[model samples]
Target: MNKNLRQTDQPLRQILTKPEVSSRMTKWAVELAEHDIGYRSRTAIKAQALADFLVEGASLAMTGQDSPPSGERSGEPWILFVDGASSKEGSGAGLLLISPTGEELTYALRFDFPASNTEAGLADSPPDGYNRGQSQERSQLVVLQVRGEYEAKEDVMKKYLAKVREVIALFDIFEIERVSISQNKRADALSKLASSSFAHLSKEVLVEVVKQKSIDQVQVLAIDSSATWMTSLMNFLNSGVLPGDKTEAYRLQFRAAKYAYAGGTLYRRSYLSPWLKCMTPEEGDYVLREVHEGLCAAHVGSRVLAKKCLLLGYYWPSVFQDAAALVQKCRACQVHAPLCHQPARKMVPIHSPWPFAQWGIDLLDPFPRAPGRYEYLEVAIDYFTKWMEAEPLATISGRQFRISSGET
Candidate 1:
């Protein structure tokens, strides 16, 4: 009870149980690390317990006893044990709610079994000669089989009578005689009802949904153990898995230490515990020289080999950019290179005026000739200084091709 509410203020817990108030609370430990003294930073411990229940009012100290119903609150209902293993079969759960300080009550995530007989009522049953009903109409015929034929049993009995009138309008029966119950035990009861049915407004929202499902199951087992540790460090760094005589790079780091001890035993019951034994053998020869020098300069994928194994160090660095863009788009140098086209555009330079300018002529042809001399070769050109002139035409009639276009 927070040490019986700090020993009921025995002179402010003997001046905060002093040694000069623990050396002035260790020289004002970072301005009294205020989680109302329990210590945590980002504020809101339920807005400091509703600012100590609006500056100590609701008849003050309930748990201490301004009014505690003195008995029957019993125990149970602070459950939260989740388990989700996967090498195929693994799922455990058990959850109870109401601890989120019920201001409007809400809790979900349920594999909804016989949840306290669907919250009492006994999950419906009782027809064939209605065993003379009475117990509140057999608990309204188990709330019409706990509204099962898929809801609408008079709209789930008018939404469970409007959640019993919004939980008696935010508590009143003396704050339900200042309710108090606490229990936690797992490893059974389906992981304590899957970690107590899920009611969270704090405990950092159930420890950020169990640290985001343990970072989505350690990012899917660190992407299948980084593709079996980059295919056992590229087949022991390119073909050398203890075949020939002399050993090398310690037989490729003893076959990348048996694929990094079977990918660190599939992330050893992971939450990345013991941080995958910090991978070693000089971090698998610096991730096999950054995936063979990034697949020989420019083609590494698995998100560039998980960003070159986290810039050559790795702390579970997982890129897997859609499995490195499906391995550099199934390379064959990106599926056979050859798809270039862009050539067409030129004209406008008819400037002459003199000095063999503007001239233009062309007629070149002669091959395997001299036997009967019919292959002609006469050329003359000068389109504004691209000058040239030659002749070897013995027959290209039509007046020798109009005197070879007036000899340039």
Candidate 2:
């Protein structure tokens, strides 16, 4: 019996001495000790309490415990931050739409022309959702915050204010609040970034924010079929039929050869020249305004303005007349007209009969002093022969002139 007990004890001792076996037994002993002390139950209870606290905190945050007072909470107002920046490069407007839940949507718009800060601000129209076929009730309360006080004192700003009022009428509740520049820095930064040459915007964000319309998307003007000037040309291009009258028929035939229809637009062809764009009276006027004083205009003269219109491949019967009238009526051109350098009187030619007979003399002084204290030059020129004679003199004496000219 003692030998059998010793054999079992020997096997147990060997198992305890091995590293892997000893580590496994030590882990089980620690787990058993913890279970006996009710540590697992305490840990589970603490975890469940932590989870409840997290769920309660999330619920309170979603319900907005720190929301506005009940009196002002009838309609939750969305905060709108707007700013405009004007610089030599360009003008831009920025707007920030901040939801009640703290989500923000930013937009930056670049103007076609350089504008003043107030004008730039005025250029910003309400977003499509606010302005599009939606009823006033559908429009949410908006709190507009700007950095500067909005005063429509100026005549131009008055028009802008009128537009702003129109936009304001769309909302059921709207309030304009003036904030400090420091508080509106984000909108200001967006405007400045838009005015800069390069924009640091992600492609995905720009795809959602920027709205670009293609040229083909714009509606073209409908030309009247009974229009007097264009009716004959349109008929000739559409159908190769001329009037029965000899004079009208011959005229139509000659003009029809020069005109052709391409993509629904009438174009006049010329020898060794690209087709000229045919425009109606209203279209001609618009072209003149655009080329003469539009965004990239230098406010050129009437003749150059007319030439520019033609060079741009546009043509009309009264193009020169329209361009001249437009330039004459331009307020900016009238106010900033440059001074004319033309002489008041006509220049008359001076005649000389002989070379030596018509000599003109003049004196030049205050030159560097020479060895003989000469500081003046006497210049004589024969007007007829175009010969000149110059001599440095110490003093203006009649004897020196006689001696220099070889006169006794």
Candidate 3:
């Protein structure tokens, strides 16, 4: 009856010859069409329905869902995620809040400091005046983006767990029934007014935060594509045993290349892909190209690659031989030679039975004893006891005469 159905008449004729096959196909088409219509609508409704059914089916499922009574519970814990930026001109900090109801609240500060997340394009100049949406905002922007981008990555599960731990620390603050986060101090202040601490609330009454469902998977595809795996592999190689071969080296090179292609250049002159900026490489071609070029540049049948391989390090910058040689021959390093410290002085304590244990002896010569007499004085003291003896001599070298006088 339908034009689309008419096109399938040849297959249907064959099926018609076998009444059983025709019956099955007709039933299958009806069921498939019905399923298609139902499936589209069910995507949203079905998940909620399933959740409700599961919650109803088991009382234990609702255990983690309990919210304390508002009167008994402290005001909701407020979280402020701050993003900051810094430049030669100044610095800025930005904040964001996630409410219990999945609302996003944002705030920004422009000022100066040694705040977190200062690195950006690595250029010497700031682009323009401060604006809320400007990327030129600097450190705050970079850190926030980094945090968000990092959270979007697959390897951020441990970090995400850490954030959860941080949020849990609020239990020390108040009887937290609900948790909210703000980018603005105003929201934080408001929440603080509601409940400054959650310590008064029972552990059972404190509601476990319902994390944003999309956060776990946020910008995931972009994150995976842009992620440079070389550093991770390099870390593994440094901390553990890495298999030796062209394959391993090639893998490392690939990661470097991808990073370079992704604007992770030592010179900071590389192109930035908007797609890559979002979170990941839109196409894997850049990564492949980067890897190939990196391997060629690093390996090129030289000992530089070998020297690099022998080193075990974390986050060591990728330095070619020229850079290594420059660092080695640095004037400051040559002039400031490595320290060679003198041995520590050994403590030698002075000991005596009464006072001084020993005394020193000396001679004073060429002294005028009288108007016409040239003379010397023989002086002695007990080394430890400090007892002194002195004798006036008519001439130098009168040791024999002094001894005869019983100076001892």
Model 1 off-target regions past 4 Å?
A: 1-104, 107-229, 232-354, 357-382, 385-402, 406-408
lDDT, candidate 1, at 147: 36
Per-prediction TM-score to the true structure, in the order listed: 0.22, 0.32, 0.18
RMSD from true fold, candidate 3: 28.7
- Which whole-number lDDT from 0 to 100 does residue 346 have in model 3? 70
| Backbone collision tally, model 3 | 32
Superposition TM-score, candidate 1 onto the true structure: 0.22
Which model is ahead, 1 or 2, in terms of TM-score? 2
Off by over 4 Å in 3: 1-357, 369-374, 383-385, 401-405
Provide the lDDT at 117 for model 2. Answer: 77
TM-score of 2: 0.32
Order the candidate numbers by lDDT, best to worst: 2, 1, 3
Q: Give the whole-model CA lDDT for all candidates, comma-separated.
A: 0.40, 0.67, 0.39
- lDDT per residue for candidate 1 within 1-408, as digits (tens), equals 241122231344344435376666654554433424432234335777887878777446554575432122532222222222111222223232333233222222333332232332221211122111111221233334333433434554445444533433442221111111222222123333333544532342222122222111333334334444444455554564453445655665764653343432322123332323334334544454446445564444455555555454443323443335445555653666456575566656687776675666666665557755757777676766767787666787888777766663
Candidate 1 lDDT trough over 10 residues, lowest sum: 174-183
Go through the candidates in order and give the clash count of each: 18, 0, 32
Please tell me which predicted candidate would have the highest TM-score against the true structure: 2
